[model samples]
Target: MLSVHEITELSEEFETKTPQEIIQWAADTFWPEIAMSSSFQTQSMPLLHMVTSLNRSIPVFFIDTGYHFWETLMFREKIASEWKINVIDLYRDHRWDVFAKQNIRSLPLEDPNLCCYLHKVQPMQKALKDIKAWISGIRRDQTSVRAHAKILELQENGLLKINPLLNWKKSDVQEYMEEYNLPAHPLYEKGYKSVGCAPCTVAIGVNDDERAGRWAGRGKVECGLHTDMFSKKDIADVQNEFHLDITKVK
Candidate 1:
């Protein structure tokens, strides 16, 4: 486990390195215990390609929220097959059953935050429970909440989170994808700058924020996975409301 001081020092060290260099460092530092998370979006392609280039067997986790666009799932299959990457599909366990039991199928409509927690955060926390470190494709420029993110963040649970693309710009991602000949998510052509679950995502127009499409009109910016929006009380209330034992969902 890296101490806070060590994380700070390493963040500074990684600041001078390219995304690939930082990824390589992470692979060397924590290979078997390290994994990458992807949403199969344009921004995630570079990191997925980079991690697989280092080690194809490195686990890549994708949360299947049961609400993703059909194209997104197809893209995941395409990437996994083409790259021969070991992609781990993580889903909210028994989500449909839970929804049925609660007589609620569309939680996002009433409470998007709770829906995200049940479908994304809880499942992800379980998937990453054994992992010592994980790589994410987040860039500081994507959202204001993520602007202050470090290249390396030590989570409260002691898991090390590496954001190799922390310093990458939108143009950098574009160039990398072009250079690598990676396929963009099908929805990208439709102007969905930021992709999440289908219900919470929409197409953004030119001159709009890159993430304007996500959780549009909900006054929500993040999906709770990347931010500390959910408090313990919030989680408890959601669980009680849905009659869900999130930790035992699987």
Candidate 2:
């Protein structure tokens, strides 16, 4: 593994490399210890294609929050099957089942941050615990939080978060999709450019930002996967942002 300073220097050089080149390096460096996550959305096609093409043995983590659209689930199955990619489904810790079940209908609307933490963030954090590297598809132009992200970020836990597509824009995704003949998410044609949990996602006009439909009007642009929240291990650390009472969780 590269030291922090070496990783920072290499990350800088990676800014000038293509997404595929960066992905190849990650695979070469981490191999079986490395994996990638995807929402199986339209914009995720390019990175998914690149990573799997470079190495099919790398596991692809998909957080099955149990709140996804049926279409999204089916689309994930189709792509994984057709491409022969190793898709791994991740779920929230079974410990939260009772609480999550009790507020299933209202969680997403009332406290999206906590809802995401329980379903997406926590599951992903647990899934990557044993993994050394995680490849994400976030682009700088996608959101304000992501705009300042580095190509390679070393987490406090010593995990390497690689953003191969950090510098790519929506145009780059489209061009790659067209060139490789990748299929779009089923909801894409119906104005759903960005897809997440069915409750949090909506369709938007072509001129709208690529992520405008995600957590729209909710003052939430991220689900904590790319933010500081991913590193947090205690619920108390984020209690203020949640509506649920953590004291009663047990």
Candidate 3:
């Protein structure tokens, strides 16, 4: 693996390379240690296509909250078939118990943030434990928080995050998918630009639908996995408040 300075230099050079070149570089360098996480969103088409095109066997971890839309599950299977990717499913083992204790079933009805904490974020953190690098299809224009996302990042947990398409625009993703004749998830045509759990994700009109329905009136857009899901300060606070050891949740 390259040193931090070496990584920065190579990352600058990587900007001009095509998607295939980047994937090959990752495959040759990271090899079996690299993996991807996909929510099966239509916007993910380009990255998924690129990874599959490289013909490398990389694990694609899917967080199965068991609350996803049926269409999402179908799309997951479809992509796995097309790409022949190694599929790894993750679910919170105590999900049912936690949901029962917390009474979280639907969208805003349940604390969507905690629901994501117990289901998606917790499982994802554990599933990614051995992975040194993670690749995601995040783009700059997706949200305010992502505007500064780099092509590569050193995550809080020391995981190397590769956002090869961080520079891509929504139109860029659409164009690549169309050019490659990639089949889009059926939900995209239904006006769902951002896909998540079925209840939290409802169709919206194209006009200023900046993830409007996600977590609905709760005003919470993240599942804690992306945001404070596991911040160092927040973890310390939680541990102090609960009078519990840190390793329990981690």
State which candidate has the highest TM-score. 2
Q: What digit string (tens of lDDT, one per residue) describes model 1 on residues 1-250?
A: 6689988999999998998899898989887899999999877898898989989999999999888999999999998999999999887646445453463455788878767876788778878889899899999999998999989988877788899999988889899999989899999989998899998899999789889999889899888778752233344565776677766433
* Least well predicted 10-residue stretch by lDDT in candidate 3: 95-104
User: What are the models' TM-scores?
Assistant: 0.90, 0.96, 0.85
Q: Taking the tens digit of each residue's C-alpha lDDT, what string does model 3 give over 114-211?
A: 56766787788777779888887777787677786667776677777787887777788879988999888888888888889887887878885546
What is residue 40's positional error in candidate 3, in angstroms? Answer: 0.9
Q: What is the C-alpha lDDT of each candidate?
A: 0.84, 0.91, 0.73
Model 1 root mean square deviation, Cα atoms: 3.0
CA error at residue 215 for candidate 3, angstroms? 2.6
Give the Cα error of residue 10 in candidate 1, in Å: 0.6
Q: Candidate 3 vs. truth: CA RMSD?
A: 3.5
**Which sections of candidate 3 miss by over 4 Å?**
95-102, 106-110, 229-250
* Clash count, predicted structure 1: 0
Runs of candidate 1 with Cα error greater than 4 angstroms are 100-105, 229-250
* Clash pairs, model 1 backbone: none
